[model samples]
Target chain A: MNEWLLIFFMAAVTYLPRYLPFALAGKIRLPQTLERALDYVPIAVLTAIIAQASMIRQGELDFSLTNYHALAALAAFLVAIIWRNLLLTIVVGLVCFTALRLLV
Target chain B: MRSPLFMMGRCFPETYLMNYRTRQFWLGALETLPLILAAFPFGIVFGALANSNGLTFAITAGMSSMVFAGASQFIAITLLANGTALPVIVLTVFIINLRQMLYSANLMHHVAHWPRFVRAVLAFWLTDETFATVSDRINRHPEEPGLRWFYLGSALFMYSFWLFSTILGYTLGSQIPGLSDWGLDVAMIVALVGIVTPALKLRADWACAAVAFISSLLTFDWPQQSGLLFSSILAICVGMLLSRSGKTNE
Candidate 1:
C-alpha cells in the first residue's frame, strides 16, 4: 500500500514539472530570473549525479587514484569531448572500466 | 534520385514542404535511435536492481511507465533498498525531476501553438533524450512545419523502447541469480557522462558543472543522498549569479 502510494506521488511530482508548463503555455510567462535559474538546472543536476556516482566509494568520498569509476568517467568525458560521439564514448568507457577493474 | 523538395529538406528551410511532416517524424526517430540503444542496458539494469531491491516486477515496470525518468527511478529504487521512508523517497525523486521544468520551459515557445491534447501528450512523453532530440531540432529549424510530429516520434520511440526493455530486464533478473550484482550499472554512468560532457561547451555550463561536482563531493556524507540535491541547488544558484554578473554566456 505504501509503495503504491509512493509511486503515485512520484508520478504526480514528475508529471507536473513536465505537463504544467505545456498545459499553461500561453496563459503564463515565467519570470526572467526564474527562467535563468531554470536554465542551469539540467547541467547542475547531471553534474551532481555524475560526481556522486563516480567519486563516492561505499558511502564515503574516495578521491584517490584507485576510484575506477572516477577514472573511467574522466576518460569517457575526454572521449566525449574529443569525438563528440555517444557510441564511441560508451564503448571506450565500458572497455576502460572493465580493464581498470581487472588491473587495479 | 531524390526530388529537389526532398533535398531542400536537408537544409534549414523555414517551412517544411507539405508532405515533409511524415518525413521529419521518421527523421526524428532515426536521429534518436542511437540514444535509445544506449539506454537499453540501463533499463535492464534498473529492472534487475529493482528486483533485488524488493520491488515486485509489476511495481518496477509500473514505475518505469509512470515515473518515466531513468535517473530518478534509480535513485528511488536505491532509497527503497535502503529502507528509507516513503516520504523521503518521494521528495528526493521529485527534486531530482525538477530539472524537467527547465526542459519544459525551453520547449514552451515551440510547442505553444500545439493543441491542449498534443501538449499534454508531449509533456507526458518528455525525457532527457526526447528533450535533447526535440530541442536540437527546434533550435536548428524553428519554423519546420511538422515539428510536433517529430517530437512525438522521438518520444514514442524512446518510451516504448524503455518500457519493453524494463520488462525484459525484470524477466532476466528473476531467472538469473545475482544479476544486479554484476556491476552492469556502470553503463548508466557512462551514458550520463556522454549526455553531460557535450553540454559543457559554454563557460556558464562549465561553471555549473564544476560547482555541482565539488559540492556533491563535499556533501557526500549527507543522509539519504540528499547531498546530490544540495549540490544541484547550490550549483544552480552559482550559475545564476555568474549569469547575472555577465561573466559567462554563449
Candidate 2:
C-alpha cells in the first residue's frame, strides 16, 4: 500500500505501452488486425470511464433525476456535438452539475 | 516525411535546417496552446482529488510529474479511493495507456530513422494532445523537416503547464476542506466527452462507444473494476468486428 510503490508501478506500466512500439519500429510490425483494433482503444476506454462516473451513485445504478452527474453529462454531450470544443464542454458540464446540486 | 522545405534548404543545408527546427519548435508549442487550455483544469482537479484521497501532497503532485497521463491518473486515484488492489490499478492504467502504443506505432513510421535518444524522449512526452498536434502538422505538410523539434516543443510546453496546474490544484485542495468531494471529478468525464464526441467519426467508433457505455454500467459493481477492463475489451472487439463486416453494428 506504499503510495510511492503504487506510483512506480503505475508509471512503469504507462511507459511500456508507449516505449515498446518505438523499440520495435521497423524491426517488427504488429498484426494488422491488432493495429486496427488499437484505434478503438481510446474510444472504448473513455466511454466506459464516462459511463461509470456519471451513471453510478453509491454502488447502484441511479438513472433517476436525482443523478445530477448524468444530467450534467447529457448537457456536456449536447454542447460537444454543437461546439466541438474541449474547454467549453467541461465548463458547461461543471456549471450544469453545480447548478443542479444547488437548486435541487 | 520529407517536405519541400527540406529540398529548398539544400542550398545551405545547415543554416536552413537550424532555422527550420527552431521555427517548427515554436510552431508546435503555439498550436498546442488551445488544447492545454482545455486540459489544464483537469490537471488541477486531479491534484485536488489525489490529495483528498489520502495521498500526501508530495505524492499527489509527484503522480502528475511522474505518470503524466491524465485519464489514467484519474482512474488510479479513483481506484485508490476504493482501496482497489495495486496490481489491478496497474493493469487498468496499462490498458488505458495501450492507446499510446497506436500513437507510437503510427508516429514511429516517420521518426524511426531518428536518433534513439530523440525517439525515447519523445516517447516519454507522448500524450493525446501532442500526438494530435504532430498528426495535424504531418498531414498538412508531410515533408516538413525538423518534426522532432516540433514534437519536443509541444511536449515540453504541455509538461510545464500541466505540472504547474497540478501544483495549483494541490494548494487549492489543501485550503478547501471538501473540494475533492464536490464532484469535481466530473470534469475529467466531461473533458473526455469533449475528446471522444468529436472523434466519433466512423460507424465502428460509435459502436465501440455505445457498447462500452452500456456494458460498463451493467458491470459497475464488479470486483476491483474488472468491469472496466472487461467492457473495454468487449467494446473494442465489437468495434473491430463491425468495421470488418457490412458495417453491421453501424
**Candidate 2 chain B, run of 10 with poorest lDDT:** B1-10
DockQ per candidate: 0.63, 0.53
lDDT (Cα, tens digit) per residue for candidate 1, span B180-232: 66666567677778877877766778898999999989998886566877888
Off by over 4 Å in 1: A1-4, B1-19, B78-88, B138-145, B223-225, B244-250
Which of the numbered candidates is closest to the native, going by highest TM-score?
Answer: 1
Query: What is the lDDT, from 0 to 100, of the residue B113 in candidate 2?
Result: 79
lDDT of 2 by residue, B122-167 (tens): 7888898787777767766899788998898899999999999888
Worst 10 residues of 2 chain A by lDDT: A37-46
